[model samples]
Target: MELITYWISILPELGNGVINTLIMTFLAVSMSAVLAVILAMGRMYGPRIISTLCKWYIEFFRGTPLLAQLFIIYYGLPSWGLNFSSFTSAVLAFGLNSGAYVAEYLRGAVQSIDKGQMTAGLAMGMTKFTAIRKIILPQALRFVIPPWSNDVIYTLKYTSIAFLVGAQELMSKAKIIASFNFRFIDTFVFVAIIYLILVLLLTLFFNWLERKLKIPGFEIKN
Candidate 1:
């Protein structure tokens, strides 16, 4: 009860942190999703050079630790006179990092789509780009949803690291509260519960989306 009381005392500060965390997660993940779709499409259909460059980007971001990537962007960019605010740096780094992984997920989804669907669109005199835009991507996006939901959840969790880069997210605020109270365990437990609730809400939303969007013919058989 004492621990709960301590947490309650800092609710206002923590609520602000939660809002910051959500903003970071939503902006970063949303931006990453857009970039990922473009990269995935390019890798799937573009010329060799474009495809190669996309592959390299995916590998580089996925191979490195996100903390290291954040540090590099936040700390390393200042030397080139491209100093960014911590929030901007966090958003940029997280978006780029998550984009690489989302690209891979989208690439696999795009490939899993039936090749005949592309051919059929071409046979109907559709340009390749038009065919992809109208036919291929719709199917691929449907297939991507389940995995992409996981990506969204992971991205939300990863936003915790923004605190290290001075973004003042939920975890960072918890750390501050803990420092003031000298109650690391209690403060962190509150943080954990908040994160768990956020993740659960996101998961429920995705599940509902899956149900709403499921195609009768394409429904996955459990």
Candidate 2:
């Protein structure tokens, strides 16, 4: 096929870009997930000061445009004598941005559990922290999975923003290839297909996870 031939001809260049994109996306998402969990727990169980701080952080990051945030980390930080590599900047921005959203997702998940569950755990001699860890989080995590999947997909797409900051991810590579080949449409279309395939695979994997972890009487509907 013409498309196959075209892709084959440019596979080497595109492959390099794919690696960069994966690196950025995986680092960003993994860091964000960890940070998000901490923020969520703070908001849910920490003292008023910690909760307030978490709220402020969530509002600040979620309020700003991703592009603006990227610019601040990539461009604004250097004025303070703190410098980061392009890849580092991209990872930081993406992680912080995704964390804001993830925090909110987790907050909702934490709140959706019945207050009775916490009460029961307390009656059973579990401390608040232990109750949350042993009782609330497991159920909440199950409820959060669908939203978490959306966040994962969003993070994957947002990796494209790395190009603006000069991180050589997939979109950046596509731009370079386009410039050299004068084939913007072709290059972008090829990149798009690659992204589509990756997303599809992620979706399938999540679906399998959902099935594997399904609660006896509770099934997540697509």
Candidate 3:
């Protein structure tokens, strides 16, 4: 069919877009996870000043729109003598925005653990920070996995927003094809299906990971 041939012709460009989208998602997810850990630890265990600063950072990111954040990173930062490529701007925006939400999830997981665990660690002659690092973090990390999976999926889909910053992500390529061929419906539907498939795959993977890491008879305290 002519439609089939048209799709075939465009697939290569869209495939490259998928590759960029995946790379952006991976980098954003990784950066966010690392930032989340630092923010969570600071908010939960740091001194008064550090805790306050961490709290405000999380709040600021969580309160603002992600689109606005992306705009600031890509368009507004040039005024401050800082410049980043569109891809880098997208990654940084997504990472910082997602970090705020991920940090909150991690903090909640940490809080769900019994306070007595920390007391026990301290009684064993461990410093507060050491006890947290050695004993508490492992449990919290495992507990945080379910929520973290959702965050990863979110980050994956949110990569489409990168197109607004002129990053050549999946959606951007679809738009280009549509513009050239005037086949908006087919191009957009194809992109949507691609996104759906990616989300479903991630869901299945996370479910398997959760089952594998589950602790026998372990219940997070309410």
The candidate that wins on TM-score is: 1
Which residue pairs show backbone clashes in model 3?
none
TM-score (all chains, Cα) for each model: 0.97, 0.95, 0.96
Better model by TM-score: candidate 2 vs candidate 3: 3
**What TM-score would candidate 2 get against the native?**
0.95
Report the poorest 10 consecutive residues by lDDT, candidate 3: 213-222
Model 3 spans > 4 angstroms off: 1-4, 219-222
Candidate 2, pairs of clashing residues:
none
- RMSD to the true structure for each prediction, in A, is 1.1, 1.5, 1.5
Against the correct fold, how does model 1 do in TM-score? 0.97
Model 1 spans > 4 angstroms off: 220-222
Model 1: per-residue Cα lDDT over 42-119, one tens digit each: 788889999999988999999999999999999998998889889999999989998998889888877877789999
Clashes of each: 0, 0, 0
Better of 2 and 3 by lDDT: 3
Query: What order do candidates take by TM-score, descending?
Result: 1, 3, 2
Task: Write the residue-wise lDDT of candidate 2 on 148-219 in tens digits.
Answer: 888888888988988898988888888988899898898788888999998998899999988889989765
Compose the digit string of candidate 3's lDDT tens values, residues 1-222.
Answer: 877787788889999999999999999999999999999999998899999999999999999999999999999999999999999999999999999999999999999888999999999999999999998999999899988999999989989989998998999999988999899998887788889999999999999988888888874544
**Number of the top-ranking candidate, with lDDT as the measure:** 3
The better candidate by TM-score, 1 or 3, is 1
